[model samples]
Target: MLLRIDHVGIACENLEEKIAFYRAAFGVTVVSQEVNEEQGVKEAMLHVADGEGGGSYIQLLEPTGPDTPVGKFLAKRGEGLHHVAYGVTDVTKAMAAMGGAGVRLVDEHPRHGAMGTSIAFLHPKDVGGVLTELVESPAPRPEQTKLKNG
Candidate 1:
């Protein structure tokens, strides 16, 4: 089902400040950044390690509006750890298996996620009160392939 630990999400009031903090404190670099309108959040994926191994990321999330999920979370719990994401080869198949096993899900179907990934969320209550995300990463682009091969 799960391939590897993809990224750990952290909710923030200010994405730029958080990104700067991570860069200055941990020296991690931002690999990608995007706003997902459907999710109502702007997010950045920061590379957690360096080298050819291409380590995992720390995802910083900022809500787009007061009514958004991350915004409500900030109002209730303040900025902190949000969710843990695990990589999967196929999120659809993973969701089906998990559903068959009676794991409650927040998303019944996979949706578009950052960096063109397919993603789904599992209910926090069913997963020890921590939000869990299933992510199927997008294929490497031609530029990425060239970089890796060169």
Candidate 2:
């Protein structure tokens, strides 16, 4: 089942500048940052408000190259809200339901996402012009904790 609004993603050319803006404007700092080579982007997650366990966040994305999807999006649209992600209990099941309902999907199957979550995207044309993502992030793995500490 779809759980909650996970985060709102924003595409940008410069991560540091935008990070500074958010830090100053909202008093928020990035909680986590990573470069997903598979996605060809560097992303930072900043907590906006506390949720039941973790919190909701704003995900800042900076494309690694002009060939990446986010890079193409920035080149065309000039940096803005890219997608809204919803947390899900099972991304595969969610995608199945969406496909059965005739929703166009960007991903035919779930793939590893930032922070080791499984994710899939629904095409914007099928979802009222908003690119939507389903994310299923499990509890932090042991390696994740180690990386955070060291």
Candidate 3:
């Protein structure tokens, strides 16, 4: 089951510049940042609000190379909204259900994503012309849970 709008992804040529822009423009700060080699991008997740057990993020993606997916997207569409990610209870189950319903999948199997989440992408054509990602975040560690609860 889909739980929430995890994040909205924006494609850009320069990650640092965009991050700075967001920080200056909206006063949001980066919560996490990493390079997912498999995804061929360097990405950062910026917090949208404060004081939360859970909250949505704005994911800024910068392609590592010209041949990467985000790179191609930039070449074609320029820097802008790329995809919307939905947090799911189980990405494997979600993929199965979407596939059973005849939705085209970009990933046949879940792959590692930023912050250790299991993720899979659904085809844009099958999802109302918007690229969709299903994300199953790793269970929070006990210390993290306590921090959130306290």
Candidate 4:
């Protein structure tokens, strides 16, 4: 059901500080950063090198407003791993199976994810006290594919 480990979501209060830290610590480059209003968060993605083997990415998630999900998470957990995202080939199918078996979801349908993917969240109450994310890719972007083909 799961294809690979997608990006891990980390909760951060100041994205610039975190970005600088990550850049200096791991030498990663920021690929994109955007605010997703529907999901209610601002996110920054730091790309990892392909030849360095395959850990996905560094996703810096900041709350959009004082009442957002990420905001609540920060209030509760402080700065830490917010969620573990698992890549699935088919999010709809995967979510259906999980739902049929009584898993609680944060969303019924997948929403826009960073890096051109679809995403859904599983409630922490149903996942052994840890929040989880299910992500489905919409095929790699053309330039990304070219990087692979090269």
Candidate 5:
């Protein structure tokens, strides 16, 4: 089951530059950062709202190579909004449900994502021309539960 909007992916030519812009203009802080070799991207997650787990984020993505998907995207579309990711309880089930419903998928199986989450992507053509991602993060800690309620 999908829980909520997880994050918005923004393709950028440089991660540090984009990160600096967000920090200077919006005071957004990078909560986590990592490079996903499989995804061929260097990503930085900036948490918004209350800084609680499962909250929305801005995921800055820098292409690792010109041949990668994000790289090709940048070459064709330039740097801009790339995808919108939704938080799900079970990526496998969610992906299956979408497939059963005839929704086209970019990733047919859940794969490793930034921040140790399970993730899959739905093809843009099937999702109203927006590349959509399904993310399933580990259960939040007790403190996060309190933050969510508070």
Candidate 6:
């Protein structure tokens, strides 16, 4: 079982700068900032006014090292849409289904992603050259998020 689009990952050379740009331009509010040493990026999540949970997430990513994946992505493709993350009910089962159908995955299991979500990525080569992310939430529903945060 899968949910809806969790968030879209955007690769940027500077996380804060882009975060500011988004905040000013779109009126989006920064919800969280976290450093995921495992993913090799400093990420900031911007919450859109579309209503609850992760209504539409805008992520600003800056690489931790020159050779990190985001760094490589920047070197090869510059800053832009990095991946489209879709929310899944169960990361493991969703990944299994994708694999059985011959989907190429970037991770063997769900890995730690921004906002404490369990996430996995499908290779662009297998998904029509568009990198797809499968993310599973480890928290309450959107309605709950709205209630708690508001």
| Top lDDT prediction, candidate number | 3
Range of the 10 consecutive residues with the lowest summed lDDT in candidate 5: 47-56
TM-score of 5: 0.90
**What stretches of model 3 exceed 4 Å from their correct place?**
49-53, 141-147
Pairs that collide in candidate 2 are none
* lDDT value, residue 67 of candidate 3: 97
Q: What does candidate 3 score on TM? A: 0.91
TM-score for each candidate, following the candidate numbering: 0.90, 0.88, 0.91, 0.89, 0.90, 0.89
What would the per-residue lDDT of candidate 1 be over residues 84-103, giving only the tens digit for each residue? 99888889999988888888
The lDDT for every candidate, in the order shown, is 0.86, 0.86, 0.88, 0.83, 0.87, 0.83
Clashes of each: 0, 0, 0, 0, 0, 0
Q: Model 6, which residues run further than 4 Å from truth?
A: 49-54, 141-143, 148-150
Error of 3 at 68 (Å): 0.7
The reply for model 5, stretches above 4 Å from the true place, is 50-53, 141-150
lDDT of 6 at 23: 86
**Ten consecutive residues with minimal summed lDDT in candidate 6?**
47-56
Candidate order by TM-score, decreasing, is: 3, 1, 5, 4, 6, 2
Q: What is model 6's C-alpha RMSD?
A: 2.3
Candidate 5's residue-wise lDDT over 14-80, tens digit each?
Answer: 9999999999999988988999899899999987754433767899999999999999999999999
How well is each residue in 1-150 modelled by candidate 4, as lDDT tens digits?
776677788999988899999999999988889989987888998876432122377799989877998999899879889888887878889899889979999997888898778889998899998788998878775446768788
Task: List model 3 lDDT by residue over 46-90, tens digit each.
Answer: 877432334568999999999999999999999999999988888
Model 3: ten consecutive residues of lowest lDDT: 47-56
lDDT tens readout by residue for model 2, 1-150: 666788899999999899999999999968789999988999998877654433568999999999999999999999999999998878888899999999989987898877778999999999999999998877744434555678
